[model samples]
Target: MSAVAHAQGHAGQGSQALAPADPLPITGGTFKPTADSLKTYQTPAWFRDAKFGIWAHWGPQAVPRSGDWYARFMYVPGHPHYAHHLKHYGHPSERGYKDILPLWKAEKFDPEALMDLYVAAGAKYFVSMGVHHDNFDLWKSRHHRWNALAMGPRRDIVGAWRDAARRRGMRFGVSEHLGASHNWFYPSHQYDQFWPKMGADYDGADPQYADLYHPKHDEPFKGNPDTWYTTDPAFHKIWFNRIRDLVDSYEPDLLYSDGGLPFGEVGRSLVAHYYNSSIAKHGGVDVVYNCKALGSGEFYPEACVQDVERGVMSGINPLPWQTDTSNGDWFFTDGDTYKTAPDVIRMLADIVSKNGNLLLNVALYPEGNLPPESQTLLSELAHWMGTNAEAIHGTRPWAVYGEGPTETTAGAFKESAAYTAQDIRFTTKGDALYAITLGEPRGRVTIAALGRNAGHERRAVQSVRLLGVAEPLQFQQTDAALVIDLPARMPTRHASAFRIAFGA
Candidate 1:
């Protein structure tokens, strides 16, 4: 039988059956599951060149409309999600998250329309959530019965998204937060400590729901970020099997792991298959795998680009990386504040200038449609990207990322740094250098990195022009700074880009 068909067979098996502890051997490829063999992998140009991507971090969790990790926290007493669930749906013992599954009728879901908006907003790629920490799959799953196709949307959400993205001439990706879900969902196994439902076990405590909640474990979920992974051999095999199924089924251009390469060999084996399968399918090593740092000692940067959650790199990194963050709460929450167009544009400039891609998540309502506010935000993003995307896509970092008074904190998990008019980020494309200002400029803008004495510039600047404007702006390059006169009226609000061309 064919490889994909063989995979479908394994996936079609009941979820109660587990794969062997030692995952199947590496698929047909030069790379093995070991760290040494996988070191040969490289970041694909498609991903590096596609500086910005949009992610649909949507799933059954959005059904609550309470924001991120609602399924787990809803079972934890004293948590806001618990209070919300209590007030709206009754106690967890009677109405568990499994009940929330059928309520997520994505009737208004229009992936094609959303893809058009994302492409227009300068997103070169799109990501669909294959599975979230809620332990619910969003696609047509052969392994799990509680999936979008069978329960909620009754649609192949991932397949729909992948098809739309491919038709629009954009790369497609899938993110798996399932690795940490085994432990992340442990909260559901506990019983309420207080009141009417006191002593009544949450639905997760029942043996019947073990497949979804994960068999009651010794570890109780406390919502700790650092301690959300499991060492249990049984869970390791399950995670390995499920993720392998996802890779084989979709063959996404990019595969994202919510955490660092998990469970040692189990995780590595899955990545090996992902890479090898990409080679066989596409006839080239054109695929990308994204994950977070190990948060400690050495990590395999050569295997995959580091994925920073809701954060950024301090400066230009030699290896390509990514920042995955949502505009608002990861799930759709009513009345949640969102990032503005300027906020997203400014972040794209800084991230790209630092040799990183911005994988932004625009949360979707439970029905698979974007909120009206999100649509307006996308329109605003389209307008800005339409005017200044030349500075974004297919660009590389310059000598210094930028010269700015804004102090930047490096590493991962930090918020986007604030910037001033002086906070200019640099990117080079062919013969041109694009200097983008984070804040609006009044009269004149100076780029100190292009200065002679600053030791960053190589040749004399030939001409300088503001993007989205007609005429070239007058500029002077001196030992101290490269100064340019501003137009009487600004072309774009929040930020602007200056295209600087050097003499031959």
Candidate 2:
């Protein structure tokens, strides 16, 4: 459980130096539990059943649609966002992320109302921002001076969302992007690649914002030697301290680290503390710990989940994992376009079929409230979720996910060209099978993977019902596949779910 950074030493270079002390060992047991021990974590049947979760990428960063971490943007010189920053707020020397905090008035933010809409839209769980790389705590923090309570929204953002989500009978969680904050804010170097032509020494002369964007030193970046940022011990200590405060304060049921866990023994200790504390509360209640780079072969055996950013894995595994994405940019902008409801639904179906969950999706909005277009998309998703709740909410993958000509890679951040109507993702609930169509069929649909003539010869069509439709539809099994007559109009516009009952 050591948070040792994986070092790739050059031929001439000596081995990397170890941290002063070893990481705190994971307590209670050494044999990391597998999927069989999931019950010990108290991962509810509902969560395993509910394959989809929603994330609120909300933060002061959302106040500026220009990009993801405005904290880092202000530091790099001559980047597009840096120029944007210079145009809007003064230069990085005069105005910093700390200054932007006050402008983040969540005046239109209504957690209860928003949670109701999200749940109705089929989000079984909600993850509020605990802290991002900006180093600003979303909740009222006992340790951090920079937080939502003292400045910005002047409200306990995460606490309010947690309370609202719990009240709505939905699981509540918190996301911590603080792991990358240490290197991300490395004072001596401008880490952004977008401004390579501007040179790295641009921020060195800024004395006014030295504390906000720490002053750089002569040393090389510790994490990656070739990188510009330095992993100074003092800065790492501060990062760990802030994260410790976050874990102790919120005790979120699910904790998601932006990248991986922080970079040392301190990070391991923090993880151990989070797990142990959750166990102490609610009598050993299980919780999920999500991260991207868990380190090769260094997996958390205690029901911890891995998150793939903006992509789906090809092969299905019994272990539960998640995928985080957004409809558009992570931050909201005036002219930003968003994904249509159909696109979102299709993505969800494909992900579920691959045995993964979707998280960290935000319908970007300004002034802390969703726009009318985003609201319309959520309403459409709600309609789809209502009709296909059986297929989506509590289902497991069948023997084979489905028969489809199209393929989506299991790599990180992979995007699909387009899904054809012929593609169908499969999930199972009890004795019934749910075939989710990726897109609307032009006319007749046939699944080649199911086997031609096999549907009519061996598989009997017991009953076929289109999701969201009141009337049961008749279907005939042919040599190719089960073909059900479609209504003149689609039940739900985006992707449709069909509940096929089978004899036990």
Candidate 3:
């Protein structure tokens, strides 16, 4: 995932027995565990209007303070995390990921404090990690003992986050990356390639720790992405039960799967159960399920909200979607580069213009606190949002997304090129049309899409004003374009939004 944070539950007891595979857990509501039934899913308005969310991708992996895949990469021969782990925590044969779990004592983690910061930064929702690819649960997990409550911080990370978000009336969500954990942890089973203990099996080879490392599977050095998900039915059942407990316990407003619907039928059943439970919990179909289901980077609004990981869509989508990215790496890295406040603002405006939400992860250290740079970034975002949030929240994509030369590269994992003053995005709320410039415009600017003769939009603009400015702007609408004269000074440095009111 190459994120800024990583995973860790905690340590106290022996591994619990894997629960026997059973039928889908929440089969009571209207939806069934079939693709056809799920096809009728409708994205909730709360989610669509909420637009932006903050995520806590933080976990034990941050204990290493290195970037992503610490648990797995630490066992590899040549990866950077391997070297870092070797230097600090010894070789995998001696000190494996299991040892890193205890180091994550979230003494500084205050969910309410972080939630307040996010709310100020214009986040309408919050997502907590239920379990990460390292297969550690952030909640009180029943499937296995390794969890936030059982081991690492010995606190219910998910519960605390959920309570914090709910206290502030922000919607709550959970992300489960356990589908690929079985294969992701395969490296732990192998030995160091070149070392004082070259062929010695890592701790993962021991039978007693199988529950934490997963039962020994073939070393998965295959570069293919498919290999990430194994075909073990028992593992699927385990995933189902753990996630079911997560859903039933939290009854989250949204549920996110790291990858596409996992294990087919089992995944579908879980979605159905989630939808059913969500209806009962909220008294309507007010829940959203996000998955990276299609390989083509297409959004399946019919089944679930499409989630593009670390990237964005090429253009406006017909239905609501999301781009889950981070200000820095997924997990916290000691010397990581963070996205600038302007960069984030531009991305948020671009994403919202394309009918997508931005779920930004603010990387946190193992101590459960944000770095000063992150706090400053959030402050910048809060300032910008204070003036321009009306253009973002509760708005839909305009007839045309916008007139912009800067285009976000299509598909997942691509962060897109930098935007320019020429790049513009559009959003609409009732009779108000918002034209958002990704960069600080010069003294004057022209928008061809708003031209009177433009075929896409023929609405007559009655008045025009900048979002934060008190005075109405001077503008002329013609067949060629709508040209507006700008004030010498703009309110925000990140982006400028012009609100055009259309009269009947």
Candidate 4:
């Protein structure tokens, strides 16, 4: 048998009896369920040049304004969210996540308005949460009955967002966090230890709700194991069917898995299917597949875009990557502190200089409106992007990432680093180079990377000007550093950009 045929035989062995209503249009490709097959993958140019994206990590979890992992966290007795749930609603034994679904009406969700703000804020692409670990589908699913259309919102949230994005000429993508759900929801089956009379079995013990809870009555509920995802073949099959349907319905330009490629060969098959489907739709493969690099041999940098959850790289990365971060908590939390506009701009410049993209999630209240502070941050970003976008969009990394004293800690969840005025990041476009100062330079700005005798300098600097300012600035190139005199007044409030022109 051929490699493709052999792979199909392996996938067919007890892999979800459920198949999509329509057959997948996989016409041509040698991408099979194997490491060698995936190694042939390559990232698209559209993603490499598009340096900024906005993500709506919004979902039913926002209904309570209670922060992230609410679905799982609410069942744990000691968690603050669980206490909030007990006070507002009843105990989990009476009310569960299923009961919280109807409250997420998304009554004020206006995708067009949000997309316009994102476009002005320099977002080249937009991503929607197809499903989080909550297992509630945001799109209208052919197989799953628990979705936005059937319940809370009574609307296809994903479809609406995609329409708005298409109208604005922005690429649309989706994120699936469902792979880790099996073990994530284990707490729902246990009863509270502190409360006396309320210590009855939670609603997850009912067999009627087993489809949603997936608890085996004969087995004991081991509340929250150190292991994250389940190793069950049955759950893998279910994931395969739901995710396949998501891909077939929306046909997104990009797909991101919250974890690494899941379920071994089953995950590889889905990835192959995604690439093939995109090739059929767009003539060639213009799609991107993003996943976390969990140090498994399966996640190769050449095959897909490596995503940092809430962090950045220290230096320039040869392959294009992405940083998925948020303004505050993943879900909207009441009275949560948010990142400043300058913080977002600085991170963007740093990531772009390292040949990476920034996918920022702006939190939205349960009613679907942004927080007042988030709105202010967006306005600030729009102003900065309007003038200095030429330095960001469609630019490549410089020979060096940047010159700086304050270095960002390189890893996931290490994004809260405080940058200074001396810290600078660089990007190049043809004959021009953009140097972004993390803060307002008070006196003179000296760039050692562009010094006269430094081999890093590509060509002689002819002139220098601030991005938003029209007047050219005075500069002196020496063996030690290229120093530029600044105007008495600053051009912008946030991070400033300086455009250095080079002669041929």
What's the number of clashes in each of the models? 0, 10, 15, 0
Model 4: ten consecutive residues of lowest lDDT: 1-10
Q: Per-residue alpha-carbon lDDT of model 4 for 1-504, expressed as tens digits?
A: 011111111111122222333433443475766667777888889998899999999999998888888888788888998999988878888898889999999999999999999999999999999998888999999877889999999999999999999999999999998876765677778887874736687777677776677765322244422234455667777888899899889989989987566666667778888887777777677889997764221466677798887889989998999999999988999889899999999999999999999999998998788899889989999999999999999999999999889968997777876888889999998788999998878889999999977789767899999888889999999888889999888868778899999876
Q: Among these predicted structures, which one has the highest lDDT? A: 3
lDDT of each: 0.82, 0.67, 0.84, 0.82
Over 1-504, each residue of candidate 1 has an lDDT whose tens digit, in order, gives 011111111111012222345547558686687788777898988998999999999888888898888888899898899999989998999999998989999988999999999999899999999998888887778788778788878889999999999999999999988877876788788898997777999999989989999998764244322444566778877787788778878879999987667666667778888888878877768899887663211248787888877778888899999988888888999889998787888888999999999999987998888887789879988988888999999999998898788887765546667778888999999989999999999999988888888877778989999999999999999998999999999988889999999897
**Model 2 bad stretches (over 4 Å):** 1-44, 187-233, 294-303, 449-459
TM-score of each: 0.93, 0.84, 0.94, 0.92
Model 1 reaches what TM-score against the true structure?
0.93
Question: Distance (Å) between predicted and true CA of 42, model 2?
Answer: 8.5
Model 1 vs truth, CA RMSD = 6.3
Q: What is the lDDT of residue 85 in candidate 3?
A: 88
lDDT for residue 485 in candidate 3, whole number 0-100 = 95
- Winner by lDDT between candidate 3 and candidate 2: 3
- Runs with alpha carbons beyond 4 Å of true place in candidate 1: 1-25, 220-226, 294-298
Q: Model 3: how far is 319 from its true place, Å? A: 1.6
Model 3 Cα lDDT, one tens digit per residue, 15-42: 1223236665575888887667888999
